[model samples]
Target chain A: MKKINRRQLLQGMVTGAGCVAAASMFGSAAFAADTRIRHFWWGNPSRDERTYKVIDLFKNANPGFDVAGETIGWGDYWTKMATQTAGKNMADLVQMDYRFLFEYVHRGALLPLDEYFGKTLHLEDFDKSAIAGGMVDGKLYALNIGSNSQVMIYNKRLFAEAGIEFDPIKWNQAEQMDIAKKLSASTPKGVHGIDDATMNPIVWEAWTQQRGKTFYADGKVQAVAADLESFWEYWKEMRESGAAPSADVSVANLGFKMTESGIVTGATAMSQFWSNQIVGVQSLMKDEIGAAMLAHKKGGMPGQFIKPSMFMALTRDTKNPELATKYMNAWVNDPAQTAILGLERGVPASSKVRAALEPNLTVSEKVSVDYFNAIQSSVGPLPPPPPKGAGEVNAAFIRMGTNVILGRISIKDGAAEFIDEASSIVERAS
Target chain B: MRKFFVRNLPGYAFLTPWLLGFFLLALGPMLISLYLSFTKWDMVGDPQWVGLAQYEYMFLKDKRFWQSLDVTFTYVILAVPARLAFALMIAIVLDKGIRKIGIYRALYYLPSILGASIAIAILWREIFNIDGVVNAVLINFGIQGPNWIGNPDTSLYTLVVLAMWQFGSPMLIFLAGLRNIPTELYEAAEIDAASKAKQFFSITLPLLAPVLFFNIILQTIEAFKTFSSAFIISNGDGSPADSLLFFTIYLFNEAFTYFRMGYASALAWTLLIIIGLFTAVSFYTSKYWVYYENERD
Candidate 1:
């Protein structure tokens, strides 16, 4: 056997390393050989199943065109999207949130759909307002997939136990308290009357809107500190009246996940909720749940507005714009594909799709659909897309609410802190 | 030059992969992040140079930046010394002639091995939650415990106690240091009628200074970079008024959640400076108390 010298060994090692790097490049090429246009969305398991079925339908109709779907939970979705966008490796199709739509579009992360409206995209069956939901700078960027509104969900069994004449449609804030007090007095010891989310974003946005105040405008939060103070006072009334649970109980269940939520566990009579979440909440409970608009002051302006639950967008990095747009159109407009999707995302944005699904709707879906249609008479216009740092502001709002409800800080100091943090976030982002 | 190149060619060739990785992966991104610290880039867009703006904002204007620093400093102060002290005490107790000590060492070191994991962080949350085991045990004693992880005043201490409990690494180091002491010295001190406490203060502590200093520097740096446990325990946003908002968590949120890459780069650089300063101070002060065994005067 011949012994290799040091120079020969070094040469061999370098050659080996080069071969490994070359192999990896070829490996990456092999990985990309499956030329499926990918669709990415943030959703739960049920929505994931619906999405995959619709993608299969699209693939079946258009043979030789394969599409892959990826789903992540809501919290980590944006983080993944940002990293992908930075690397210029975004999915072909992205599910867009309203708060992020304008930011993404302004940065040229999404392709504008205006150029393809008559060519490959069809939206004649959509309401003008529904079509306008994804409009940024007066041009279409994202296409609205579904519409939802702020809603309050209450246990029907508890309402019946109280035996009160309840009309959530016309009920003022005072009436809400009266119903809550009655519910609290009649309910058993452990079950509180309502969730301790008086100042939650789901409630705070509605409250701010009812006062005719925009939650955000021109990179600034429009509501003054006093507006937040009043929001605190309104909820403090409920807490002081023994209607909402204590701070520790509230903190323990900070989120609305099915596993530990107050409403699902029968620890609260009512929960601050969204129209899109009705089916989700009902899936966890055996007791019947009812849905309606949130509390409003006497003669206050309507704050509840229908919002696009999510939008479908062709990413700027998409390989084939025409084909991606066709897939998106089929996902929303094709009757069979839409039926397969059902109302898993939320209420359909297309009137034709809603008409097609009405016959096959389940009882709980019907209740949610009814709630969606009933609120339109009093529903406000769609809110403008939020500024860049609006997501941080959301966390700040929750933290401030926790501070107030938990009695860590006074409402005034909490408001000041929130405003300071919120303003700095927006200011720095722009 | 040719002769030098020829002589060192094999050594250089042997280090080729590491050198390539160092230059490409680590140093390249570091230099870019340093440049990014001077610009304004939201991940999707091209970075626009805005010299000194990010650093200026971080120092003078950013409230959360200061808050993160305050929280991290408090954690380092509370956790590092307490952990070292606890580890030393355990090491001293274990150094005595006890049977089956190897099993005890492994058992005590188990938490350090598995403690910095996401599963343990989740368990930490369960232990400090309102109805958690801590409160459950407190209830048996008829004493109602405040929500340790929920309240801002006490939330950080749960993280500190977690830091203290992972004292296994330093305890192992201390045990080795204890074993290295010459038994003859202790016997001589005993003949001189020196008390055990006196011998410990004079011999054990002074002899262990170098190891203790090494542990202090290592532990302090580790404490400053505490991320996953705090991030997971606080549910990623440092809730309950940002009390658990470690500097690394804030930097992560800035870079990823807000996509403020420019500012996050500045934050990362500041943290590097902080860790550098801490290590430098430890080294600078070591000459005063950390005595070597065979140093010539």
Candidate 2:
């Protein structure tokens, strides 16, 4: 009798476990029928959480449509995207950067959104410049999420301590150097006045633009070697004068976040960041931080231009383009969604949405929005989207800058090498 | 054939999964990649047969290709021997009158399992950063440490140390090799008044040469294929003037970042050849040193 009881128990256990497995398998199958499209983007944890919330809102609003979101860290986003593109298995909705837009669009990996502008996407409220920034070869391959420009973000506490009256818009090349030197002289040991921008392509782009040349144009690097040489020489002098951190520290902090940035760490008085990044930086610091324009060149043209923070692109192979388009529309146009996403991507590219969110704006958001508004007339026209091989050229620019900063290569030689390498890359790419 | 299939049915069944995986996954991609090496494939477009152009570019024009090779070679030369030597030392020490050998062995082997993990690589980056724990400790001692991961001069060395830190597997193998040596041989040398150092040089080393040969080949191949540590350390761009640009990192960048898949494929094939040559060289050199127990004169 006991043996029979044991046999019954064993049978019951097996049946129960099998039923549970079968139920879960079928349960997921039912859920899978909800037209679930995959979305991919890169962001810090906070942005990821907010994005997921926005995705949830989209899902809730439209039953039977779902976006299964995937987020990789900033460092790994590109390599993963390339692999997915090669496999012809890209996510339906992808976050795109302007620098990378031309490459993807030219490869036909992106869907042209022009056909859907009136039919599915309602872009009436978006600023013309924001929409224009996403256009390539007359086809709208992406839609701008927001607009931003590079701004000089400084530690206000450090400036106040150094007794310098900082006016970022008026501070050109000479004033910046003088302030950097003054701050460096007054700061404690191990602290520098400015973070190094010697190797940053963004700064070089502005510098070259100020000199009436684009860093890259017409599918080639247009900046003259003499200009790059002067830029390097200027930065080199700054380093030598104890105005910036040593090359090693600068290299370490390259692409670092606020926590490790010289501005937040009190190792430097000033650094450059995108206008939208102020809130993120402030969140990580106890110090009072302020934003300013990247210093203009002495006797040079206006170089600053607002750029799309990022774009929402639909992959060419997406099985659910309409739903994806709807999701993207909600992302850029929905007031509630915009409120939640509020300048995380950047100040809203949609004028309607920006105006709607104005009444509920936090002080920090107002500051960024006001700054972008105030700088409108002063900034230059947006340059064309970087062409193919621009990624390699940008990397080479940084590397040559490092070589100059480290004293490994003379400024003249570095500039010459950069021009040769960048020209070849661009030529081959074209 | 029917009889053979019936007789070896269980064996074939056991091998089927791996066989299916090999043909479907590994072999298919490898074959495609080999074909791709001769083409100008941007991965998103049609692959154009450019026959030897990618190879020509890699060999003659790409400065980064040569730089990555130099970095990888330096890493392999330094890391493999240091790792093996450290493994051997620990194995010998553990072989001597040590207590709780099982626990000690497990403790020592933990890093080998964790070494290649992304978490560990991240931890390593933090440990070597300018404001990291190493510098924090150095500051306490009034010694300002160089930016280990930032400074190009010291970046590769930090990666080498990371490679050396995961010597547990080799150490375990060496321990087994040490145990297998006949106790009688060491006793005989001792009876003949051989000192410990002399005994180690003559009897122990000669017996250990085969083990050493095996380890050198394996570790050399491994060191060549190391990607994750360098990739994570350099943030995938091999920054700080490309000092940490390993061969694989360069290959990955060419293929993905630069959209030069065909060129990257050529680089992959070239690396395979280089590894093959190193293995062959090691085998050729082994004849002079390696001694088999069964092959006495």
- The C-alpha RMSD in Å for every predicted model, in order, reads 6.0, 8.4
Candidate 2 per-residue lDDT over residues B51-89, each given as its tens digit: 999888888987888999999999999999999999999
Give candidate 2's TM-score.
0.92
- Tens digits of per-residue lDDT for model 1, B23-44: 7766677778888889988877
Q: Whole-model lDDT, candidate 1?
A: 0.82
* CAPRI class of candidate 2: incorrect
Candidate 1 per-residue lDDT over residues A1-430, each given as its tens digit: 1222324433543332221111000001111324578888998889988888888889999998889787899888988888788778888899998888888888889888999998899998988888888888889998989889888888999889889767877678888877887888899987878887744776888888888887887667787778778888877888888888777777766554566777888888888777888888998889998986887767788888899988999888788788889998998899888988888788988888998899999877998899998888988887777777788888888777777887878888887777777787677566
- Model 2 residue runs over 4 Å out of place are A1-36, B136-142
What C-alpha lDDT, on a 0 to 100 scale, does residue B52 get in candidate 2? 92
Every model's TM-score: 0.93, 0.92
True contacts kept of each: 0.34, 0.38
The C-alpha stretches of model 1 lying farther than 4 A from their native spots are A1-35, A255-258
